[model samples]
Target: MPTEETQTRTGEAPRRPRIRLDQPLTPRRKLIPDYDPEAFGRMSERIARFLGTGRFIVWMTVIIIAWVAWNVAAPDALRFDTYPFIFLTLMLSLQASYAAPLILLAQNRQDDRDRVNLEQDRKQNERSIADTEYLSREVAALRIGLGEVATRDWIRSELQDLLKELEEQQRSVAKGEVFPGDGDRGRDVDDR
Candidate 1:
């Protein structure tokens, strides 16, 4: 018995004795590089590092150092976040609170970008699938045309005539009977 592969362009399967499954044996998700949750998750460390710049570290260090220096050097009146280090402790606590959330926010933005990239990739894959289907249909049409041609003799005669014409053209070129862009003679033969 013939298989579906040998079927007509009309989408009918070849005559067979047995029933076939409607579903494909293996269906794959056309995973175009879309926003992968795992890929976005892995970028957390890098985004955190980028957002926690050298300037941020330097300013935080300076604030702590200056606070310490003022408390130690001042004669009680110059003390604001002073001696038993209440102000310093408060500032450090505040920094810690804000820093974690900022890093997380940066990661969230990166995740959004990854999601967009994935969506674009999926669209491209869909377009590719559409193009593939179109070409497949065209190929099926050509196959049907070849199948319907009733006379082998007519096809053979046509091919032989085409080949003879090509041979004559080649022989003319070899004998220098043709020249580059000599439009008149080429047009004359083409008309024939």
Candidate 2:
């Protein structure tokens, strides 16, 4: 047995006492009997499912009709429930009492599953949006880079301009006019 007093070390202020993490927890006897909750939940779901089926409704209707017919037509000694049908009403009420909870339990389980699925879908949509945004940004960057690069049509136009400049310089030299920027090409051509 350990005392409930707070443990303190030197130079530390007293804090609220808590259970020791290093020690094993003591087993407690519960007031209610312990059972597997998961198993019970599954059983309740099964019952709820059965109750919702058309076959269950048909069977219940047939049984009730038979019960009514038997009590109405059968002799007094054989009939268990008479004119008021109190026993049938009690049985139906009992069944409703149990069925309501089981149906609610099944609905709760379905709600939990739906909530988890919705969360996963939301996360998936978020990731998809992020991926799409990232891809779009990458595409935009590539388009910008491609715009900066010289295309074949631009290169062709630039080469045509250079050719026209060279033709004009040749004509000027042929007419014996000295073009200032012709440099070594003019001298080399004259020597040739």
Candidate 3:
């Protein structure tokens, strides 16, 4: 029940004035009936699409020609919108006024859809680029790791060196090249 003055008392924090739903300060307006805005927008788009077609143009032309011919040719008693065709012009003007707004509404909706689509495409492109960069980095790391690992040619060369040393030792033993522990020094010096 605080009034506006009470809500703004000095030396204290200002408080928001409370609204009473049961007793509105201003006269209440009648509630408007609810309707679907999307449906209305779709209907406007349909009308705008129809208005842009060649068939609509042909039909409008035929109607206007027939109206003029009838009004000019018919008997005076039967004719309406005679000579000046002011009524026909007024009708066309009214049609144009409604059509312009509907066409604008349809264009606005299309622009919104295009904007959303472009944003999604941009996000997709970014994800694709990130994935490509990650894969490239992984490939580079694998190449560097493989460079430090052993290769088939190095193992073959090491095996060949060990085989040559073993063959030299076998030849020396077959020729009776004895050491001091073998006790063949007397036979060795007599042969020499």
Candidate 4:
């Protein structure tokens, strides 16, 4: 049954529940306004760059000269700042204060980029070293394998030794004598 608290003046039923359990609660309003940090950082860097340029110095000099000249030469009614020029000093101080922080912010961002690049370079060097070690190991394995394999020179030397032994046996048979074994041949050579 519907109560007076649940029903609208003319509504049959509410389209949605009074409270939602699945969704997150709405955040309370804050005094500070929302802003993108990256956008602010980029804008500060641009300001810092402009302030660092010689063109900005030249323009600032021209403006100061113009301000002093106008205040000194112009009639009393037209002059804004007098001989003291307190307003000009305040403006310069204000600009310097803002510029110092902006320049520092730009430097911080550049340092972050440098750190990331250095880390990436270190990882690349490590990978290269690992790859080099792997190649060296593979080359060593191949060298060890090749050491056991018979070469053409070794095979030729062995065949020549066998041929000389066969020729010696043939010579012995032509003389109607038996050929000596390798041990007896060595003894016979020593005796001769």
Clashes of each: 2, 0, 0, 0
Worst 10 residues of 3 by lDDT: 181-190
Tell me the lDDT of candidate 3.
0.85
lDDT of 1 by residue, 153-186 (tens): 9889999999997777777766767643553367
Candidate 3, superposed: residue stretches over 4 Å from native = 1-32, 165-192
Q: Per-residue lDDT of 1-192 in model 4, one digit per residue for the tens?
A: 676666776576655647878899999999999999999999998998998899999999999999999999999999999999999899999988989999999999989999999999999999999999999999999999999999999999999999997887777656646535643343343344
Better of 2 and 4 by TM-score: 4
After the best TM-score superposition of candidate 3, give how far the Cα of residue 93 lies from its true spot, in angstroms.
Answer: 0.9
Poorest 10 consecutive residues by lDDT, candidate 4:
182-191
> In model 2, where do residues sit more than 4 Å from their true spots?
1-26, 174-176, 179-192
TM-score of 2: 0.73
Ranking by TM-score: 4, 2, 3, 1
Residues 59-164 of candidate 3: C-alpha lDDT, one tens digit per residue = 9999999999999999999999899999999999999999999999999999999999999999999999999999999999999998997889987888888888
Q: What is the clash count of model 1?
A: 2
Can you give the TM-score per candidate against the true fold?
0.44, 0.73, 0.70, 0.74
lDDT of 4: 0.87
| lDDT per model vs. reference | 0.75, 0.89, 0.85, 0.87
> Which of 2 and 4 is the better model by lDDT?
2
Candidate 2 lDDT, tens digit per residue, 29-78? 89999999899999999999999999999999999999999999999999
